[model samples]
Target: MTVYSSNVTRGLMLAAAFTAVVSRSSLRDLSSVSPIGYRIGFVTPQRLWTSSNSGRGSRPIGQIGQQHNGASWEEISNPKSSKTVKLFKAIHKANKSRRNEIGLTVAEGVRLVADLLSTENEHSKSLVRRVVISDALKQRAESPDGDQYHRELIYRLREADKKSRASRDKANAIIINTGGKDAVQACCGTVTSQGIAALVEIPTYNLDELSSEGEEEGFYLILDGLADPGNVGTICRSAVASGVRAVLLLESSCDPWSPKVVRASMGASFRLPVIEVPGDNALDRISDALKIDPKRIFAATMESSGDAGASKAHFDVDFTARPSAIILGREGEGLRPKIREALSNGRISSVHVPMSDGVESLNAAVCASIICFERCRQFAQKKSDDL
Candidate 1:
């Protein structure tokens, strides 16, 4: 017989180790006749394996090993399966009608769910009904954040799911996996799926609740007829950053819970008070409920032919003087006639950013950001002056 080197024997041992690790049952009765030395434990979805030179002869590996403790998982392969299709419909066809009927929306990408995990808001955390992940996303390598951050996210999600199950709460969030890459792509329109997506109940907040007099006094950002999801999302992110107390989504505005808007918001939607105002007289209802003085409300607009109805510059307004509300209008048309009537009658003030002669107007989202930060700046200045 040919003489085998020690290295060759070691290679054979490693092969046995892998086989035993993947097939946990096989290791239980592994024969000692082979010199393969390895230990396996199944505590999670991932397999664990270690090699050591057990002086003992080969007996069934099972006799030497502990029981596998991994949780059970289901693998779905069909993109058209009932579960996958339902998720696709909710995420892709996120119209008001669909959302109202289903009472759910999709939050996709790893960052969204990661942020959801970290949020301190109990109500926000409770809104998540389920988290669906694609196998491809689960195996994704670490991002620039760190080598272990992705793995850490998986661990935390699993832990949270475990606790939820133990509590047996109907609202507890569940963790699930898609059957394949096709299913993941179908759900979020991206093959990557950022490794995870969440099925979250659309949070409902009444305008009256946000306007309660007992609530802390702060600026409210009102969105009017802005149909672009990207703009709506960016405005929401900016509003959160600039310390707005709440955001009012007018009926004509795009769905705040839509996937595109959710992604664009960078998770700010979860932290902010996003109330829907679904009627022709949204502003009127809000004013009445909040007991808002017309003089304290401001509408942002492009400068008109003359200064008849519009404030000359955004900087000219005294945002910090009192509790204020800023209204952002539709993309192309600017504010509606009713809003302008408020401005013209001096019931509400109109504030506009002075632009160069050639530029007619800024994007709705950009205008909102500028006005919001201006308010932040003014508030900061006021705080400093008081000091």
Candidate 2:
């Protein structure tokens, strides 16, 4: 409370009036600020001046929340009530009928989803219906220090979305944010969730589609009553690596679209054509698909002293001679009666992976891998010899 000169008092009064006008103008401009700077606008004096810039040639506040990449980010607070979440749960529960009805399945884990997203196949890319990511994961992925793979996945998703929007064909994946880690974890089928998942449409194929081009030789893998998902998945992965034309699953076989199988296959299910043979005459249908003599089909059997001449070692079979179909049966039980009867009648040949004495048998997956790779090795050698 000190006295001031007349000139100083007048200047103080002018400053007070100016400050009052600015406070009033800022309050008016607060409503025009974007969500990005809403809280800062109230505390920072410069933000008050920036609001006018938004209207005078700067980016509009309305456009601030819009992604330039055309991808839509939706926050799901109640994932329990979300339709995507329900679908994910249904797929995870292995409700085969429901899955078939919807024609959709879930692919979890970052690597698995990333693989699907990054694939160049248009059909494969179109199969990705949705990508569900946790909000925390999204933030981490967008962070400066995030993994390059993770960032690339995000960029690819956004670019895919943009392409879909431009084409208006719904070929892109819809991105969903679960808003929390728990929601994403609850949707995952694995013990440790990676906070990301994708809904994939099951691809359909026909017998005609299984045929190879021209004289290019290839083989088919038939799963006869293979109920173990792990074994089936591993075999599928090996088949794809060894270049099988397609995988045929008998009606008695486990669902190839199941989460456990998809996980164990490590994305091979999406890359390879998996067809289901529904009727009891699966062998006939498979033979027709192969378009080869039934004798070319080989049944994988275990080695035994009693069946020395009856079965040939897998490597001994001339797989490069013609197109072939290899049949791998369920674990514990070797081949079904139908397959054994066919083998005995010379309708199909019996092949066994030679094992050392004292070993009863190899895992079904291991057995398939050995035979498939051996076929590949033989064909490769034959190609080199011809060259």
Candidate 3:
């Protein structure tokens, strides 16, 4: 074999080292780049967000031996099978409290986080102060302004993630961790080249704030005594799609913000302003939110030919004329008696969808969808005619 030049090997290694160092180094000043910097979550020395993790060989950039620790350059890879959706309700509740106490909310995933940074919607943007992502958890600004900055995803994971009775004591807040070795790992490491790409952590938001964009004629669906995340999710997806404004939760209905619901919603949940009515008071809250005074509330039933009315089919009524709060109760029992009182006393009228006699009722979500669409259709058509 021909003798190889040691000089050649040395030269190549040196070239690779310089490239790694430059490419991986955190931007000391954002102004240095031509692109506008994102006003990120609350944290400091914004570079700290990037410095601790990115330079650590966790990134695609090779040639840098920069501390891979136990995680090697050859090993770090893309998220293979991401089954769970965003950390929704738990995160939503946590941030909702933050909004009440401090005016902030949280968002997960690269696109959502990026959109918040770039969003034109005044209601949902800017309220972010902290963010946790596998791909990018960071504290970017040298100081928080108390304004806004990026904090490394790990800082929050360690400091805020521990679940205690004290944390659970809050109604809406929750602490959810990505659950496995394959999931993103937290690190105290200064260089995070080997870290997982779970960047979003604290989505910054609390729904207590009303929209400044102006509220719609605003009707909401309250899932009471109903169980099943998929059913709740389907109702929510349809509600948002048909312009029901928002959904209110009063029972142990699956957290509409959970990963499953979010995916089932097909992104409608983000666009809707759903809120929870603590405990069994959900029906009351639904009445209040719609300003129906419970006096105008209505029961939807499958029962035919009665004064409180029959299964008239939800669309048969003058949906636009009626200021209504409707309920789809438990699967087998249908509407509860307490809920029926308002309807019986003329506090509300009972309405129903006429289905085959043997067909007990539609899927809770399906019923809600058909009803909501009918109401909105009337309103939409009226609006079109007015124009």
Candidate 4:
């Protein structure tokens, strides 16, 4: 018989209604009584035993099968909260798979439930279609891996809700909503489960506003003309593999935070910082930011009066000798002179993968991988030399 715990408020209110069932002699054959079901808390092992019989006292909460459609799903019952109700429906639709597969995507942590309330995308608003959180399990998420990294993650979740309304609106465009009530808490738990999202879009950043930041000591990949989402996404992955800590995109570059880019990065976009600057002074702005010597800045192009001419093998450059950055040109046009000129006085330099006589050059991301690994390999070699 379908049974419910006393914790299920709606069901408990109906207990008087349940007590009436026992009087019907027609229901004497224990199994003959209709199974009573209600939207209630999960049944624990102890509660499971009690449920087999027909008693009417409170039972302790316990872990059992959690429906994916969720228990604490609160429909927008109050007419005053119409917006919230719409969102509930949308989330239910988006999470259909998790509900079907796991029968347990609905989390039980309070903080996780809180996070679910903060959905800030358009698509997500649709998801908060009208569902409410039904139950929050008492168990909480662990304290992250440790002190340092743990704080950073907490900061991301807390700060994500406080950002501009404009940004939160972008979240409304997708199935990713957080910063709300019941369903919102569910949403936050769903994404944070991975310990990291594959791609997290800065909902507010337009091409004009994205800015790059990095250590003065390591390399960053400056994507010039690689606008294709697939190419941008792959290069993001390549950046991480090659040990590049960040990605700097030119004005003409594709939005790295776009859904396409997010999907393509396969999650590197979350781990790597991506920034953008205006197209007019793209190179000029980068020079001003990292603030490393102009001579150390390297562009991925060959030009007259360029550093590539004087440099040793792309692999031969003393990567460990000083801090550096790699600047990639358009997928086809290569780096413009303005780009090369921006670094002539700075610590920036340039590198080119030598073609074995015929092939013109590699794809932007591929070329970036070669340059990045060469530099990383150089750094590793330098450390060994020091030891």
Best by TM-score: 2
Q: Write the per-residue lDDT of candidate 2 for residues 18-126, one digit (tens) a residue.
A: 2332233223322332222101100111111113222555332122223545446655567665544655775666456544534557888877777777746555566
- The per-model lDDT (C-alpha) reads 0.64, 0.68, 0.44, 0.45
Write down the TM-score of every candidate: 0.75, 0.78, 0.51, 0.47
Q: Candidate 3, which segments miss by more than 4 Å at Cα? A: 1-216, 306-312, 384-387
Candidate number of the best lDDT: 2
Clash count list over all predictions:
14, 0, 49, 67
lDDT of 1 by residue, 1-387 (tens): 112224334334433433332333222333322333221210111111233225544432211221124353345556563443444544465446544334456787776776676536565566665666777666563345445657666765776666654653323435455446666666674555665667665555556655546543568888888899899899889988999888887777888878788889977887777877878778788888766667777888776556465575888887776677889999888788888877778888777888888998899889889989988898789899999
| Tens-digit lDDT track of model 4 for 2-77 | 1334434433332322233222222232233233332232221111111311255533111111122433212323
lDDT accuracy of residue 169 in candidate 4: 39
| Candidates by TM-score, descending order | 2, 1, 3, 4
As for lDDT, the candidate ahead, 2 or 3, is 2
Where model 1 places Cα greater than 4 Å from the true spot, the runs are: 1-72, 82-85, 119-121, 141-149, 304-312
Q: Candidate 1, which ten residues in sequence have the lowest lDDT sum?
A: 39-48
Worst 10 residues of 2 by lDDT: 37-46
Window of ten residues with lowest summed lDDT in model 4 = 44-53
Q: What's the CA error at residue 39 for candidate 1, in Å?
A: 54
Off by over 4 Å in 4: 1-216, 302-308, 340-348
